[model samples]
Target: MKILICLSNVPDTTTKAKFVNDNTAFDTTGVQWIINPWDELALTRAIELKTDAANTIENITVITVGGKDAEPTMRKALAIGADDAVRIDVEPKDAYFVAAQIAEYLKSNPFDLIFSGIESADYNGSAVGGMVAEFLNAPSVSAVSGLNIEGGQVKITRDIDGGQEEVSVEMPAVLTVQKGIAKEPMIAAMRGIMMARKKPLNVVAPVEVEALTEIVNFEMPQPKPACKMIEPENVKELVDLLQNEAKVI
Candidate 1:
């Protein structure tokens, strides 16, 4: 069995976000980028699945849609344990375009399982996995927190309203993993980093796909107001504020 894991590079959460191109595109200047934290869960889980009994997974290939600027994150994924990597040479415009590129590639190179994060850290658009599944005509499970494989079938568990829901499905399926799918991400050891330099990182040309949405402009959220302090004796005033101004009740 072969596994395809989608990887995404995003700005580190500490970085201050800025927009360029007339406030239509995110600026990359002096920004630190890392593999999306959610994607790390998918990668580590894929690695664990590949090493389980029966050894069903022959390869865990990580793929991403971006230019050379994203190669560092791909390399980091390789260091974490992906067998190989595929870099689709395109600037990721949106979720649809990126998923279309991945789905197009899957038509020629099929896999038994595909993994992606439930959402990206930057845009938080939880749309790629389902879109890829739709384009490939494959079954998909979203927001899965636990996974296992047995006898060529995958057993998945996810949280519902109050409890967990377990399901089983055959191969050739897509899964969008959420938190708890894997613990902390594996730190790339020096040996693994050295090995990653030798691992195969293939670059592929993107298939044609028109973007369905365009960013016209970006506006950051307004600054919040300062907290107010009320004396203990102002109980009646607090009630008035809650009823008329704050309006919670």
Candidate 2:
């Protein structure tokens, strides 16, 4: 069984976000890029699944919709254990266009299981995975926390309303995973990093797909208010402040 993991290149979580071009574009200066955290966990689980000699997993491939700048993240994924990587040669404009490009690729090259993170760290859109599944007319499971292939059966444990639900879906399905998919993302070893240079990173041109939405502007949230300190003797004052200024009570 061949597995395809959809990767997203995002600014590291620790990087300070900055906007430019009159708040119309993200500032890329001195930013470190990495694979989306959730996607990294998905890739880790994919590698773990392939480790079992019984699963008969053929190969693992990572795919992304991005231009040349995204190759570094893809290479990091290869170092994590993907057999190869594919990048659609285009800047991802929006969720729909990105999903369409992936779906277009899937039409020509099929895989038994397709894994996508529930959302991208930068945008947190949470829309691409379901959109890709819709484009392919395939079933999809979202918010998956547990996944395993046992005796050729695909088992998924996902979060539901107030509880968890276990499901088994057919092949050629998409799974959008959240946290807990794996204990933690696998770090690439020195040997794996050297081997990643030899792994194939395929670049394909994107098909024509108009983005459904446009970014008008990006507005940052207002800065948080300073916390006021209170002493043990100021309990009444604190209560007064909470009731009047804070307005919680």
Candidate 3:
């Protein structure tokens, strides 16, 4: 089995987010980039599948859509256990555009299975995986928490509103993985890190896709209001405030 895992370069969770270039683009200066956390689950599962003897998954390829700066994250994925890496040299503008570029890339090489995060941490738009599946005319399952492969078919369990659902699909499908499906991602060791430098990383330019959305401007959200304290002894006053002043009741 040849599995393709789609990764993303995103700002570290602790990085302070800002906009620049007249608030039209994200301010990447001084930002530390990392692999999208949700993608880690997919990567981990891919690695697991490759290790399983019954499945015999031969190669695990990791791909990303981003500029030059994204290569490090791709390398990181390789270091973590991906056999190879591909970086689409483009600054992703929107989910649709990114999906189109990815779909174009996959058009040439039909993979047995494709994996990606449920959503990117920065944009939080969970549209790319399904869109790519649609473009490839493959079955798609999103936010899958459990996955197993048997005889060229995939069995998946995904979380619903109150429970989980089990699904089955054949090979040559796309899956977007969510958290809780696996443990936290493992860090690359020294040997893995050294080997990653020798691994193949194919960089390709993105195919042109007419962008449908453009950012007009950006504004920070309103600051949260200060907290008001009420004395424990003022029970009646609190009730009155909830009824009349706060109107929360």
Per-model C-alpha RMSD: 2.0, 1.4, 1.9
Q: How does model 1 score by TM-score?
A: 0.93
Give per-residue CA lDDT, model 1, range 1-249, as digits (tens).
899999999999798989988888889899998988888989998888777858678899999999999999999999989999999999998899999999999999999889999899888999999999999989998889998887777889976768889988766999999998898877888998999999999999998899998878998889999977789999888888899999997
The candidate maximizing lDDT is 2
* Residue pairs in collision within model 3: none
The regions of model 1 sitting more than 4 angstroms off are: 230-244
Rank all candidate structures by their TM-score, best first, as comma-separated numbers.
2, 1, 3
Alpha carbon lDDT at 156, candidate 3 = 92
Q: Which prediction has the highest TM-score against the true structure?
A: 2
Task: Report RMSD for candidate 1.
Answer: 2.0
63 Cα displacement, candidate 3 (Å): 0.8
TM-score of each: 0.93, 0.96, 0.92
List candidate 2 stretches off by more than 4 Å. 232-240, 243-245
Clashing pairs in 2: none
lDDT of 1 at 98: 97
Candidate 1 accuracy as lDDT: 0.90
Ranked by lDDT from best down, the candidates are 2, 1, 3
Q: Whose TM-score is higher: candidate 1's or candidate 2's?
A: 2
| Residues forming the 10-long window of minimal summed lDDT in candidate 3 | 180-189
Q: Which consecutive 10 residues in model 2 have the weakest lDDT in total?
A: 219-228
